[model samples]
Target: MNNNTVDKSVLNTASVKPKVLLDDAPLSKFHIKIAGLTFGAHFTDGYILGIIGFALTILTPQMGLNALWTGLIGASALIGLFIGSLVLGWISDHIGRQKIFVFSFILITVASFLQFFADSAIELVLLRILLGIGLGGDYSVGHTMLAEIAPRKQRGVLLGSFSVIWTVGYVCANIIGIYFADSTNPDIWKWLLASSTIPAIIILLLRIGTPESPRWLESKGRIEEGQAIVSKHLGENIVLDRQEIASDAGFKLLFSRKYIKRTVFNCIFWVTLVIPYFAIYTFLPLILESFGMSSNHSTDFLLNIILLVGAFLGIYFTAKFSRRGFLIWSFVVLAAMLGMLALLPSTMTLLLVAVFGVFTLIMSAVSNLVGVFPAESFPTEIRSSGVGLATSVSRFGSAAGTFLLPLSIANLGIQSSMLILVAVLLVGLVVSVLWAPETKNLTLNRASKD
Candidate 1:
C-alpha cells in the first residue's frame, strides 16, 4: 500500500483482464454521451483558438497594430495555454478532472464574451490569454476524461475523433470569418471574437451533470465508486481487482525513470508537429497572399473545407492502423510535402495551392495522435500532469512559431521558412520511430507502463 510503489501484480493483471472486460462490454448510450460531452470541450476550444486568426485580419487595420504587436497578440493565448496546461493539469491530478473540466468551460465562456467590450489591443490580448487558459485545461482534463472512460478497443478512434471535432469547430470559425471579413461595420471583429461564447455555453450545459472519470476514482482508491460507475456503463457483473490500483505518486512521478521516456516522447513529438501547424494556419491569409493567390475570406473558407475533409479521413485511419505506423507515415509524408513546397518555384500558383491542400490533409491526419498519445501514455494518477506538461512545452514551440512566422516569411522568404519546417518534421519522424509506443488496444494501466 506504499504510496510510492505500485502493486506490480495488480498492474500485471490490470494489463490483461480489464482490457478484456472493457473490450467485450457492449457499446452503450453512456459511452456515446461521454465521448460527445468530452469532445464538446475540444470543439469549443478549437473555435476559440481558430477564430483569432480571422479576427486579427480585421483588427490589425482597425487598431493600427504593427508586426510586433500583431505577433504578441497572436502569441498571447498560446502563452496562456502553456501556463494553464501546466498549472491546471497538475492541479487536476490532485483535486479531480470533473471540477477542472467544468471550471474551464465557465472561464472560456466568460473570457470569450468579454472580448466584445475590449476597445484596445491590450484588453484583447489579456482576454485571449484567459480564453487560452480554459482551452488548455480542456486539452489536459477533457482528453484524459475521454481516455479513462473509453473502451480499450475503441480508445484510439474515440480519442482521435477529438481532432475531427476540433476541425469542425475550426472550419465553422473560418466560415463565420469569411462571412464577416468584408463588413464595413466597425463591430464585425467584436462579433467574431464573441461568437465563441455560444458554443462554450451550450457545451457547458451538456457537461454540467456528467460523472467523474471512473479510472481516476479507482486510482484514488475509491474502488466501490469506481466499480459502480464502470458497471453502470460497461455492465454490473464486471469486477475490477485490487492490484489494478496505481501508486499515488505526486507530480515528481513524471520525471521518474518509469515515466520519463513517455514524457519526453510526448513533449518532443507534439512540439515538432504543432510548431509548423500553428505557424502556417495562423498566417494562412498572409501566406496565400504572399503566394500571389487571393487572400479573400472565400479562399480561406474553401481551404478550411479541405482541412475538414482531411481531418475526417485522419480519424478513420487512426481507427484502422497501428498508432506507431500511422504517426511515422504521417511525419514522413508531412516532411516530404513541406520539402517540395520549399524547393518548388513560387510562380506555380495553382500547383502551390494544390500542394498546400495536400499538406493540410497529411497534417490533419498526423495531428489526431497528439491528444491520444499523451492521454494514453500516462497512468491515471499523472495522466493530466503528463499531458499538461507535454502540451505546455509544445505551446512554447507553437507560440514561438506564431510569433516569428511573419518575420520568417519576411526575412527568410516563404521557401526558406518552409524548409525550416521540413527540418522540424523530419526531427519528429525520427523521434517517433525511435520512442513512440504502440497503444492501440492496451488497457489504460497497461498503456501507462509502456
Candidate 2:
C-alpha cells in the first residue's frame, strides 16, 4: 500500500481481552511445527557463522592472508547481512513471510556449497556474503513469523528459543571445529566451510509446511483467507488476538513520528549487544589465545557450552521477569563484567576464566530479548521492517567490530580492546535505562503502541 498504515488493530484489542483464544491457547503440535522450522533455520545460521572462525585459522596460512584480507574475509558475511536483512525484511512485510522464509535457506545452502571451490580470499568472501544475505533475510522473517503466531503466555520462551538454538548450533560447530583441529590435512578448511550446506538443506526441507503468519494476512485485510488458515491449522475456536483492517503502509511509515523512537530504541540495544558478541565470538579462539587463557582450546570450548546454557537460562528470565527489568539489569551486569575484565591482570588465569564465564553466561541470557523486543515493538505492517532495520544496524556494527577487532589487538592490546567493549556496553546500559519500554504480558498490538 502507501505510507498511511495507521493501525486499527489496537483499537478494539483492549475489549474482549479475556476471550481471545490465541492468547490462551495451550501448546500444540502446530506450534511445535512452526517452532521446529525456526529451530532448523537458526541452527543453520549458527553453523554458518560459527564455523568460519575455526575455518579461517586453517585457511589463513595456506591462503597467505594478511590482517587486512583476514578482516575483510571475516567481516564480509556480516556486511552482506546488513544489506540483506534491510531489503528483504521490507519485502516480506509487503508481500509475505513464508516465501522469503523458505527461500533464504536455498541461498544459504547454495552459497555454502560453493565455498569449496573458492580460490582467492575475495572469492571466499563473496561466497560468505551470499550465505549471509540469506541468513539476514531469514533472521527478519523467521522471528517475525514465530512471534506473531506464538501463544501470549508462552511467547517469551517460544521467541527466546531462537537464541538457545543458535547457541546450540554454535556449540555444535565448535565441537566439529575442535575435531578438525587435529587433522594435518591442509585443505580441511574447505570442508568446514562447505559443511554448512548439509544443515541448510535439512532446514530448507523441513520448512516445506510452514504457514504464513495469519496476523500478516489479516493485517493486510485478508480476513477470510487469514481465518481459513487459522481454522485449518489452529483450532476453529481459536480467535486471533487482534482484528486488523489493512491500512496503507510503506518503508517511510517506519520513520514516522509514531514509530521512529521505537526504531531508534531497538537499534541501539541490538547494535551494542551484537557488536561485542559477533566480533568477540567470530575471533574467539584467537582472542582467548591472546589472553593466554586457552592455549589448548579448552577455554574456548568451555565458553561456547556456557553460552548455550546461559541462552537457555535467558529464556526463563524472559518469561519470569518484566521486559524492561530484564533489559536494564542485563546491560548493568554485562557492563560490569566487561569492565572488570578490562581492569583485571592477565596473570590471574583462573580468575580471568571465571570472569569470562560469567560474562558469557550473562550476555547469552540477555541476548534472547534481542529477538523478542523488535518483533514486539512494531505493528504488523511495519514489524518486519522495524526488525530488519534493527538487524541491519546491528550487523553493520558487528561487521565493523569484527573487521577491526584483530587490528585493535595488534595495535591496542587485548586489555584496551576489552575496555572499548566496556564502553559499548555502557552505551547500551544508558540507552536501555532511558528508553526500554515494558512490553511484558501485553498483546502484540498493545506492545507496539507503547
Candidate 3:
C-alpha cells in the first residue's frame, strides 16, 4: 500500500467522525418519483372538494335540504378550508413540513371515513368542515415541500403535475359516483366519498420514505444535514455555511418597493386565475343543470370526461409551453368555449356539452398552473406563507362565487352567467400576459436569492 491507501483510510475514519449521508442530489428519476407520490397525497382533498360540490346538488334535493341551505352547506367546508390554510401555513413557517404533511392526511382520512355514516344534512356539513381543514393544510404545505425539494429546471413541470393530481382525483370521484348512482342502494355516494380516502392513506404511507426538504432544513441552520441531503440527491458534494445561507438582510430585502410591487402583482394575478376557476369549476354540476341537461348520471359522466382528458393533457401542455403562454391559451380557449355556449341555441345543447368538456379541460389545466405561481414567486423563508396567504384569499373569491353563482343562475340564467364568467377569464388572460413572471429557468433557491 502507498500514501493513497493511507489517505483513503483517513477518509474512512468513521470511529472518530460521524458519517454525513448525502441527501440533496441533482434532480434524479428517483426524486421525481417521490415528488409524484407527494403530489398524489396532496391532491386527495381537492378531488374530494370538487366532487362534493356536484354531489351536494344531487344529494341536497334528495335529502330534502333547501337550495340556499345546500349552498350554505357547500360553503362551510371552504370556510374551514380558508381558516385552516392561513393557520397551517403560518405554522409550517415555524415548525417543519413533515409534521403538517402527515397530520393533514390523517385528518382528511378520518373525515372521509365519517362521510360513510352521515345521516343528516347537518352531519354532512360538519364532516365537510373537518375535511376542509385537512385540505386547507394540504394545499399550502404540499406545494411548499415539493417546491423546496424539486430541482430548479423541472420545477414548473413538476409543480404543474400537482395540478394534474387534483384533476385525477376529480375524475376518479366522478367515475365512482356515476357508476354507483344507478343502483337501488342509497349508500353509493358514501362509497364514492369513502373511496377517496384510500388514496390519501397511500400518500401518507409513501411519505414515510421522503426526506425533509433541504432548503427547509438549511433554513433552520441544519447546515451539515442540509448539505448531506443535497449531496445525495444532486450526486455532488455541496459545501454550505452561514454566509451561503439566506442572510437576515435578505429577509428585509424582499419588502423593499421593488419586490413589494411584484409580490402584490403576483398575488392579484393568481387570484384572477383562481376566481373564475373555483367560481365555475367547483359549481360545475349546478351550471350543467342550469343548461337543461339531465342531472342524473349523465352530468357526472360528462364532468369526468372533461376532468380526465384535461388532467393529463393540460399538464402535458404546461410542460411543453412557457407558463405564460399556456395560461394565455387556456383562458382564450375557455373564454371562446363559454362564448359559444352563450351564443348557441338550446337544440345544440349536446354539441355545446362536448365543447364544454374541452372548456373544462382547459380551465382545469389553467387552474393547475395558477396554484404553482405563488410558491414560485417568494423566497424560501416566506415561500409557504406567501403562497398560503394568496391561496387563502383566493378562496374568498371561491366562497363568494358559491353564494353568487346560485343567485346568478336564478336571475341571469346559465347562458348569461357563463358569458360573464368568460369575461373574467379574458381579464385573467390579459393580466397573466402583462404581470406573471416567467419562472421557467429559476430554482426555488435562485428565485429567492437575495
- For candidate 1, the per-residue lDDT at 37 reads 83
Q: After superposition, how far is residue 66 of candidate 3 from its true place, in Å?
A: 0.8
CA-lDDT, candidates in order = 0.85, 0.85, 0.69
Model 3 residue 295 lDDT score: 61
Q: After superposition, how far is residue 60 of candidate 2 from its true place, in Å?
A: 0.3
Cα lDDT of model 1 by residue, 127-175, tens digit: 9899889888888898888887777777888899888899888888888
**Worst 10 contiguous positions by lDDT, candidate 2:** 11-20
Query: Which lDDT tens digits does candidate 2 get at residues 1-450?
Result: 567765577666654344346656777788888888888888888887888888888899988999999998889889888988998898999899989998888899899999999999999999889888998899899888888888878888888889999888888888899899878998899999999989999889888777788888988888777777877887767777566664667668778888777888899999999989988889887777776776466666678779988999999999999988998888888888887777877798888788888989988999899888898888888888888889999999999999999999999998899889889988988888878877776676434564
Error of 2 at 249 (Å): 2.2
Alpha-carbon TM-score of each model against the true structure: 0.92, 0.93, 0.84
Model 1 misplacement above 4 A: 1-20, 241-244, 448-450
Model 1 lDDT, residue 419, Cα: 88
How many clashes show up per model?
1, 1, 13
The regions of model 2 sitting more than 4 angstroms off are 1-20
